[model samples]
Target: MCNNISFLGPKGTFTHEAAYILEGNLIPYCTIPAVMESVSNGECQFGVVPIENSIEGPVGLTLDSLAHKFDLKIFKEMVIPINQNLIVNPKTVMNDITDVYSHSQAIAQCQEFIRDNEIQPHYAVSTASAAKSILGDKTKAAIGNSKAAEIYGLEILKPNIQDLDNNETRFVVLSKNDHEPTGRDKTSIIFSIYEDKPGMLYKILGVFEKESINLTKIESRPSKKGLGKYLFFVDFYGHRKDKTVQNILNELDGLTYFLKVLGSYPEF
Candidate 1:
């Protein structure tokens, strides 16, 4: 029940669209760090940040920030379906465009279209920023959501330009307030093994198997301490407070360099 929420944006970014449910004061931040920091420092009651994508994988900054920067907890999650469109000025045509602008990730999502059109890709801070920058320019275009087109008074030259038909991003709601256990919930955690012994990862995962916990996702990110040192981020179907999950976590503490429970949130 947050009264205000912050998201990565200047508006029209997918994160902005995903945050509509809060129905609160919407604050747009420039970067993921700024969004998380806003909630950590009490500038806002909640912050919405993208954590993973169906095609491109985990958002690195969000993972690193959750693992290292803030002690915030995830309150909820939602999957945002991405429909990247080719947006242009009303006077522009496909062949008339000289350059296309968008966030790097958006450009990648629309690679097939960009390659086919032969337009140079310019990176922008956000999809909405790209749309805003292309105003009054017949030679420029942007790749972003339809909202960006509406916000910037542009037109959708092509719709659903993403490489895949069902492209989507998973976003998490971050807050200083801890969430109570919902009957259907998932727990996220990050752990690092002190030793690089063989089967260490398998052994860690074994705890989940022993306790009958169903793991939905597992990914390794750099530990940032040194090369080849990594921390494993695991998501599974159950709250941290559940008896089985607590038992597994208690056992994991002894086998890990450190075990940090990122949060327990209701599944999207």
Candidate 2:
């Protein structure tokens, strides 16, 4: 078991909440990159980072880091249901809120609420940070989870304020080593096409199709090495140990300029 784990936090961020479910000594860093760096530098045995939100799509930095920076393995995944609430200092009332605050994603999730309430949206680095700032202000409110309100001793003015009732975010657990396959597992990989030519991507995808592998997710990110170049990240429902999966990866190696299996773990 990992003795120490780190996550993106100042306290009360969603990532911090995810870490609570895993057993470890919790350390909080201020940014996503910092969290990954802590795990890469051995400051923590594992790191928890948000990968994507149901409404917002893939987290760009986490995807980019997996492809370009740290050679870490995604050992586990946690799916959390997101519930954004309107919180405020005890003295603040709905009528008193002129400026609303929360993380950028939170703001996006609560667009209808913000627009309906007629408050200016102020973006904070984290929902907890926004909740913390409501300490002495009466004309401001924040959108965050119940944990943030409890930690900051604020009042929840409204509950379930997110536009959609079923909003969720997927987070991944990062570690230095890979795990053995469970009967049910998922593999993640990144590959760059040799050249941006017609059917180049289609031909690469054909290998997966021919093998009958089920792809769970696929996303492309800038390579950062050059313009118009991209690295494709994919999640498929099979372990690297499986013969069919192994054969497909072996063939994929010859089809791209570079191919890397990020990691595989039991499906969540």
For each candidate, what TM-score against the reference?
0.97, 0.96
Please write out the lDDT profile of model 1 over residues 24-106, one tens digit for every residue: 89999999999999998888999999999988889999999888888988888899899999999996778899999999999
Give the root-mean-square deviation of each candidate in angstroms: 1.2, 1.4
Off by over 4 Å in 2: 225-227
Candidate 2 local lDDT, 1-268, one digit each (tens): 4588999898898888989999879999998888889989898999999998899888998988877788899999889999999999986778998999899999999999999989999999899999998788999899999989999899998999999877999999998876699999999999998664667789888999999988999988888879878889889999998999999899988888889887889898
Cα-based lDDT at residue 137, candidate 1 = 92
TM match of model 2 to true structure = 0.96
Instruction: Give every collision pair in model 2.
Output: none
Please give the range of 10 consecutive residues that has the lowest summed lDDT in model 1.
Answer: 194-203
